[model samples]
Target: MARQCDLTGKARQANHKVSHANNKTRVFKQPNLKTKKVFDPESGQTIRLKLATSTIKTLDKLGLSKFLRKYYK
Candidate 1:
């Protein structure tokens, strides 16, 4: 649709959505928890998530600083 001015020979066109390929759409599937984690999109790195939060806290408190140094960093 377009709007026209009554006093002058001028018109304004309405904005409309442009036609384009639906490249942003994605198909999702449920996770398979049995498999180990493989990727991290933010860092583009492969990682494993086998440790629980409780175990991590224990390690931090028990002075296993040398053992968990890699993961902590």
Candidate 2:
């Protein structure tokens, strides 16, 4: 599987690293992702997902069902 947030689809970003001499090096910035087990209220089951930290925070606030409804729709 790719390094990405399943819920938000956050993926690695291309960026440049600048040195003191003004030389730029290409780099990839990866999102903060974690494997989490969230409970589905509607289904009454736990589902495991690879999610970003920010998405986890939002999930905590909105819950699994509400968050899915808001974003997936």
lDDT at position 15, candidate 2: 99
How do all models score by TM-score? 0.21, 0.93
Q: Give the TM-score of candidate 2.
A: 0.93
Q: Give the per-residue lDDT of model 2 (tens digit) for 1-73.
A: 9999998999999999999999999999999999999988778899999999999999999988889899998
Candidate 1 CA-lDDT value: 0.40
lDDT of 2: 0.94
Candidate 2 Cα errors over 4 Å, as ranges: none
Give lDDT tens digits, candidate 1, residues 1-73: 2233221223433444444863454433322222134344457786654433444444446534443464456
lDDT of all the models against the reference? 0.40, 0.94
What's the CA error at residue 47 for candidate 2, in Å?
0.6
